[model samples]
Target: MSPLALGALYGIVTIIVMCSGMPIAFALGVVATSFMYFFMPASSLDTITQNVYEEIASVTLLSIPLFILKGAAIGRSPAGRDLYSAIHAWLSKVPGGLGIANVFACALFAAMAGSSPATCSAIGSAGIPEMRRRGYSPGFAAGIIAAGGTLGILLPPSITMILYAVASEQSLGRLFLAGVGPGVLLVILFAGYAVYRARKEYRLAHEIYSQGGIKSAYLDDEHFTFAQKVEMLPRVLPFLILLIGVMIALYGGFATPSETAGLGALLAIVLIAVVYRMWRPRDLMPFLNSTIKESCMLLLIIGMSLLYSYVMSYLHISQSAAQWVVALHLSKWLLLAVILLMVIVLGFFLPPVSIILMTAPIILPPLREAGFDLIWFGVVMTVVMEMGLIHPPVGLNLFVIKNIAPDIPLSDVIKGTLPFLLLMFLAIILLCLFPGIVTGLPDLLMGAR
Candidate 1:
């Protein structure tokens, strides 16, 4: 059979198995193993064990567990609440300060946790009720954090970025740097919209108060003395320093990704212990359990994914697909739009990790041939993934916020998150118009891939 036919069959069979309610890991594993047994020689079959071992044994991959542990350590502790509280204290004077604080807290936590659901659940649990109490609309309250939760993948130490780095064989450090600019851009846009919406909401409340509404027109009138704000810092400052210091050390070439993740993870544990007083085994078990569970699942997927990719290589499917795409002679920009659209559609069904693992083998080689910078494309891909976490069918953040604010309808959660989703698209546009936004930090500090 032609390589194209083989590739099509592989995809068809895999999709059929997955559609039959088989787990994704099993589907990918079964398909790859079946192909190896049937299409490849018996000698090739013997290497499957070695390949799976070698795939998981990667040094670059060690950071996955460490990062997961660090995120879990903080996510399970009071660190997120502290972080949000301190930020809210500082920003209280601004319109939509509560919402904006949630965005910043999400961005910072995203840097620490590198997982979207964890970020959403941690911050949403604290921020939603607080916003609702302050008279912010339910949809607005839930939407902002749901949108902000996406930062977990766009910010540095993002597991998604790490996975892309491994799949595309790009630098993890460089991809981390690449995400910073776009991540900050999205934060700024989310905050800006929050302020605008807050002002409008305040105006509406004031008009209602003129007719003797139950409450005053003011939106909580929260205030904090500088000294009080400073007081809120002690519980929060160490983690801030840990975040900054980790980036500096990683980008400054002081450590590799694994070492940086290890140091950051250790500091995260210590800070949470000292700050949250979580030294007891009961306190510590939450982060540990989460770390082991998520880490093992990711490693399993990685091993299976590597095997899946190996099958493509063995069949020359990837090579043929790359050549066929190049032969299309399409504009690079158009090709990018098409690829991103495909990613967005996939997001409607599969989670980000699955989308990346399943498509990277096929999508990446073509992008490389089109003269696109794989690192820049990686950032773009992350932003697209962020969009996936907030929408329907598989929008994890939507459900997360809804769970936090059970009184709020899921439709309200979806409607509230829609604006931030658009802001994500705007961020993507900015990156496309000026690709430098994605590459500048990495190119400047890491000397460009």
Candidate 2:
């Protein structure tokens, strides 16, 4: 068979295997190994060993585990719960105040968690119950949590950004910096929509406190004395400190991305273990185990992506596909808009990891060859990928909220996410129009790097 034909066959088979319940990393390895054995220039066993190990040995990729650990540690902390409570206290008075708070809380959690499902599960467990108790419709609660959970990849320390950096061979640190603006904008859009809904339906003007007012309940109440507030401050202060500290270090070049992640993870563990005593040594075992499983899953996908790209490269398929894209001679903006639309559609079906691993290779090279900014494309793609988390049917976030909030119907979750999804689509367009919004941070940082 011609290399192009073989490459196309491999691509189709890989997707089929993944969709058919085969593991992605194993499927790619099997396909690549099979291809290597069957094609010309038959390789020795050592060649396979060397190639696989080399791909996995990249230093740039080391940041994935550190960042993943950092997110997991924080997600497992008492401080995380306190932070959620603090956020809820402030935003609970709106019509769907807890729902809106879920979005903002997800955004904040996204900064630390670095992955979507983790963001969904953590926030859903905490925020979904609050929304349920407050009389928010179940569907809306589930929909909001599902939709809000997607912020994980758009925010800093994102595993998607790390993977993008690996696939595109771009700077990890710059990509981290680049996601900040778009992530913040998404949170604002989500919060605004929630507030709008509350006003329209519930006539809720402000968040309500358990005891009618913040001062009476928080300040003079016997339930929470002055000393208790001081104690609460410790639980509260670590989250803020970690956020500011990580950003400053990244922005100032005080630490490389991996170094910063290592620092963040170490600090997080200390904050949980010793500082707050929320996590004992025994408690940490489960979190560590969770982190390892997640890391392995991500790394496996990445390794398989490397092998798949290698197969495509050897077959000259990536180049051929780019040639076909260039042959169309389409306008850049029009082409990008079409691609973004496709991503939104795909978001409804494919998980983010699968989408990023499968589509990025085909789309990214062509887009960059057409003179679009890779950094800007990264942010746009990440946003579109996030949109999938809330999309109906297979949306993982929806399931998370549903699991946490069984009383709310599935339809309400879908309805609640509709407005936010529209807002996300708008955000995609604005980022496209002003590529500066996405590119500026990365460019500034790249120069420094």
Model 2 TM-score is 0.88
Cα deviation at 39, candidate 2, in Å, is 3.2
Best by TM-score: 1
- What tens-digit string does per-residue lDDT give for candidate 2 at 1-449? 76557767877876677677767678777777777676636754347666666876977678889888888887766555676776666654444556576887788888877777777778788777766555555666666677778888878888788778877777777777788888878888877777766454343212343337332211221133455446556666777788889888977889888788899888888877766675666889877988899889878877776776776677677677667667788898877877777777777666666566666667787798778877778888888888788777787777776776776677787787887789988998788778778777777766733
- Candidate 1's TM-score reads 0.96
Across 11-128, the per-residue lDDT of candidate 1 in tens digits comes to 8888788788877777789999999988889898889889989987989889999999999998998889989999999999877787789999999999988889899899889998
TM-score of each: 0.96, 0.88
Weakest 10 consecutive residues of candidate 2 by summed lDDT: 215-224
Off by over 4 Å in 1: 216-218
What's model 1's overall lDDT?
0.88
